[model samples]
Target chain A: MTALAPPRLPTILPLGLARGALELRRFFRSRETVVFTFALPTVLLVLLGSVFGDHAEAQGVTSSQVLAAGMIAAGIMSTTFVSLGTDIAGDRDDGTLKRLRGTPMPAAAYFIGKVVLVAVTTVAQIVVMLTVAVAMFDLSLPDTAGDWLTFAWVFALGVVGCSLLGIAISSLARTARSASAVTQLPYLALQFISGVFVNPITALPTGLVVTASFFPVKWMAQGFRSVFLPDSMAAYEPAGTWELDRVALVLGAWCVIGLVLCLTTFRWRRGQDG
Target chain B: MTDAAISVRGLRKRYRGSRRPAVDGVDLDVARGEVVALLGPNGAGKTTTVEILEGHRDRDDGEVAVLGTDPADGGRTWRARIGVVTQSATDLLELTPAEAVRHFARYYPDPRDPDEVLELVGLADAPRAVVKLSGGQRRRLDVALGIVGRPELLFLDEPTTGFDPQARRDFWRLVRALAAEGTTILLTTHYLEEAEVLADRLTVITDGVVVAEGSPATLAGRQSRPALVGWLEDGRPRTEATATPSALVAALGQHFGGEVPGLSVRRPSLEDVYLELLSAAAPEPALATAGGAR
Candidate 1:
């Protein structure tokens, strides 16, 4: 007689990956998130680059390369801060998180799936944006592998820090519409003062520069500039120094602060006591 | 024989800033393979009690054991043994029905075949896209997901709340099949007909307490209550409420010395008993507690 088959054990990776892929598909299918994450960044990058390319010295940069670096930083900002913030708040408001909490799936597994999807989408956005900058706008690549490595690490850290902050902010929004409005303010204001546009240190008041530096936007842009621009490029700046070490410290601080806030305030249910 | 499917005592929960409790001192028990329904009106603590038992919410003071473990501290094993069908349907728009079911099945140690569950829920023909399914079909998919894990005890929170008549009957068939297969079920619904047809026993809760509990016919001693006999007499409507409907019918026949005109007999139905229970449990709306309502 033939023997019976042995019992099978559950495996979680394929399941996690499948879940992440579906979430990514859902994200892309939503026209609002797509326009904000993909089209909006491309449009903003092009519009800002063209408007100020010829007037570099007046904008505190000798070349367009500095502006390109800042714009790439802006793209990272939008991915981690704006897109993730609104998405978390929307899920909380719609009872999706409450529903998921009832299921048997591990909570960590769900978060890992979200992070995986974010990684894939964020990388794609970076590549598409950089390709457009290089081919259309004559932007140059980083001179060495070390520069690319630095860019990748900074990008990863920036995504984590901003996404955590986004999750934290989601706890404050009462509804999806309010979440959208509340999250956009940071994205717009940070992009302006973090030197994505004209240098805020020169154009804005000193107090604003000092205040914006405490945030992740300025450090991310400074770190991006450390990779793309030449070593002597720091001489032409308002800060007047590269301050590579300071960029690491400031971004590191933002990452810690964001994580703490997320852990403390992130909620699975919509109402305060639900 | 020693294994009770579910047990709870003194289950209490209160929302912040709420003066009254949602689930206050509720005691419940379900034997192995028994199908029990919790029948109550809106604002009853049925959802809160079920959620607490599912380990999704905390209770203030309770001794609860589901599948032989305290739900408040039950970990992965306890969760794997329980299946919960929530009120909201799956809103994952990108995944197909088949894909969603398979994804959820992986979360359990032992899961049923995805195709078999799909067929059971009558979604075999429409497993491609969840976005394409009709309302009934979507609810069927929800059931499929809830049961694909082959849970020992299943909690269905208002499962048929939005179903049409035919769909509701179809869902009853599914519930019966699962119960026959020895899957213990605990359901909550607004449909009295459903409870009358499906539940072996039921408990009626109001204002965070049980006012009545028994078999459908026996609750509030309804089977022994007076029945109504009505007919047309002298072109006018005539009626009497009596303990013996047949006796009243026979008396009418003797008085007329023939069949009574427009003879009809009616008894207190499950809905009647349910309404009476609600009214008796709380005489005024002031007794209606806050939290866990709509």
Candidate 2:
């Protein structure tokens, strides 16, 4: 008798896209995820923007504008870091990851799907926060094509950096309950030191500013500020300039570090000690 | 393809920091299109062995081949040929059954129609939402996903653990239908009745070792054991274990000249032999043997 033919393997791109679309649908359907990812940032933007409306703090810009710019970076952190971290940890706890491991779908495809989800949600969060800033708080839109260019790269790099960090940190949470608690501590700390809450970036302690500069959050906030604020406003920045080159360098380094950490440390299943 | 869908020799696995291996020198062979049940109590290493074959868990030592490929190095092509129904239920709470099945179907090159697979698994008209499904219906959905790829081999780990009697029977029919379609099935279950009804061969494991292996009727020499001749005589119960139960019944018929009251010619069941095998394999064999004698 003739031998049977081998089974055909699926290509990664289409399968990963389908998986990503399914995860997006799930994200939108869940009320808790929607509330946390979208509503919380918008609410923070409005609340903080209204409380500090049009009160020029430094470099002739209102407090709301600085916070609005800073909130964009904070929003990316919320969606990519806090949201994705808990979701992955919960998937591990619920055996969803284990079920996927038994199938022919490549693990890289699974991660690609996760990255796609993060990219989509990051874009959505940025759009919502910026719309609210311009429409409700009188925050000016970026005028020059150069400003828009800065916004684009910063947004892309921030999403990639925070998403990789999220996947890497999610391995620390062994259960669904601990996942949120584990991620929230660093998320809150980053927001404070990155000057998302404070009026003037220089008002923060020198040591705290130095510490925040070591991470992506501070650079992301700085990138957004350069795009939203006028050129003269750069004098009030910690470096007394927009420092776009430094922003690129710091965020780029984080992207590489986060990717390496994820590849080396992520666990598909907990207690797989071997 | 090899004649055996699954073949293992001297399979061994020990969890880290544990004194004993989870699976110790176990051997198993399942022929194509045959249903084999690995019977054992909890912590008997049934799940460990099945996971090793599925390539989800690494085995410390042994030779294992599923569909002529070593599971340790099996790639996507080999994985596509086998399906696994894991013990824990998957949580796809947001997607409907149709959505979930169709999504997973894209991962396979050739798959059964999602609608038809749902029908085959007896969830044709069930609710759309996965979270809304009953426990049995949810399980049927799991089985649907497992077979949607039209796998040549299926591994089910306690497929009907929480199923009610009627639901369990329906699941058995589904398994039988899959087997009829030439799917080699290896199921692990602690229920002896389920094993007897579903498996063509039974392999009993205790303390990570295979103590007995045979057809359900013959495992542990069950068929050769003496039948118990029980009856009521003058309002008192009497029982006699003898090899020639029919002959004793004939004599009783001759004496009574009619039916023997409360008479039951009971032979050893699969459960009895399974218990005996487990007891013999237990660490405290003397205590178990004494318990089995009564």
Candidate 3:
């Protein structure tokens, strides 16, 4: 027998990135999935903003600009929560998870791959939303480095939290066919009460605003508005100021919660053996 | 036992809410560099046994040491030493065979070159997405991925289910080449011919237990089974079963005073031996009547 050296298992990070690259390639190849998933936020921005933009402008900010900012947050959630939930469910149904279980790749690497896939798709959503806002809605890019820094942190927390959440809920779907309903319903409901769908955060009932306050969607919307809308709109917020610190706290806490749920609920197999 | 690449003792698993254990008590071992074929009827615990050995499922009771490590707690290093090809692996959709193989190649420390692995599996030039490949091509792709890590032991579960005649023969050659390289293989297959062609020994399982285990030629005393002797006499056919067919044939030749007219002799084939074993080992009268699934 030839003396064979023990083969090395790749470290988590590079393997994770490689998995991430593969995920991105697969995600884009299904052209309809890309078009439909990406089109939702952009279409909402144009149609909703056009109908609501004209005189809804208050304190030097048009409704389109306000709506566009919040859409970036909603758009990120769409890509992270809904897209990932469906993607993971699809992976389970199509036997991706089973095959990966046999490989030397770690479970954390698989999560990292999903995160990477979400990060890329989320960035694409942000870019599309930003371009539309600039070209059509008269929304300007943040001028100061500090303002841009807020965008970065908010983007980071939002993506990580929602991606983790998507991973957690993906287990609830028994089949990929049902994943759409399992993912879409919760986030769709959150957007409405979180003030992404409904205009003027205070127009909703006090109880509804309080309920939305406990979730990440409201905080994410609040953070994005702080970046994209003028400073004066903070006065129009229910709290009469952008609670950026609380926004960071709530989103960060969700990231931890999401990770915990993922650790507890993920499954590699969906069917009976033998 | 020390030299065994895979060893199991009293392995048993019962699925929740099921009346019977899927694997009642399976004791199997594959020595280093040996090709062992597991043969059984459907729902006969063949998959259950292999899955337990692969560490893909938990056994209710038993001992399993795959590559000398308890599969239940086998770490990443242990996983790197083994290759598993299961029937349920249907992922890797958009990438071409080349792309998929190259990507999987990254996870191993000393994986075979992606191009060479692809070529060995006869998919070196498959340019379309994996989702577009035929069933046979996909099975070959599965083999390519299974061997990419240069694993010391390979567990193949129904690897040739969708393979055509040519593809099956080609795959048999591949298995032989891998065996010659000293890779211990424990393969589950329904094809008796496949077992005869590739396995050093054959194990026949039924209803979650092994009924017989031996080299292909001697399994269930196949070589010792009575052989049939036949000849034409006065334009009428005559036949008889004899433990010593050669002596019987020679006597018949003497009776004919020259080559006995249209004489023939035949021994029980592997399939006949296997069927007899299954019937003998059947736990119920109904199952014995049901016969072997093949």
Candidate 1, residue A126: the lDDT equals 84
Give the RMSD in angstroms, all C-alphas superposed, for model 1.
Answer: 4.0
lDDT of each: 0.79, 0.88, 0.88
Q: Which ten residues in a row have the lowest lDDT in candidate 3 chain A?
A: A1-10
lDDT of 2 by residue, B153-191 (tens): 999999999889999999999999999999999999978
TM-score of 3: 0.91
Candidate 2 residues A144-218, lDDT tens each? 999999999999899999998999889988787899999999998988998888856689999999999899988
Model 3 lDDT tens row, B111-134: 888999888888988989999998
- Which pairs of residues clash in candidate 2, taking residues 3 or more apart in a chain or in different chains? none
In model 2 chain B, the worst 10-residue window by lDDT is B285-294
Cα displacement (angstroms), candidate 1, residue A261, comes to 1.9
Q: What's the residue-level lDDT of B41 in candidate 1?
A: 76
Clashing pairs in 1: none
Residue ranges of candidate 2 with Cα displaced over 4 Å: A1-7, A272-274, B232-238, B250-261, B285-294
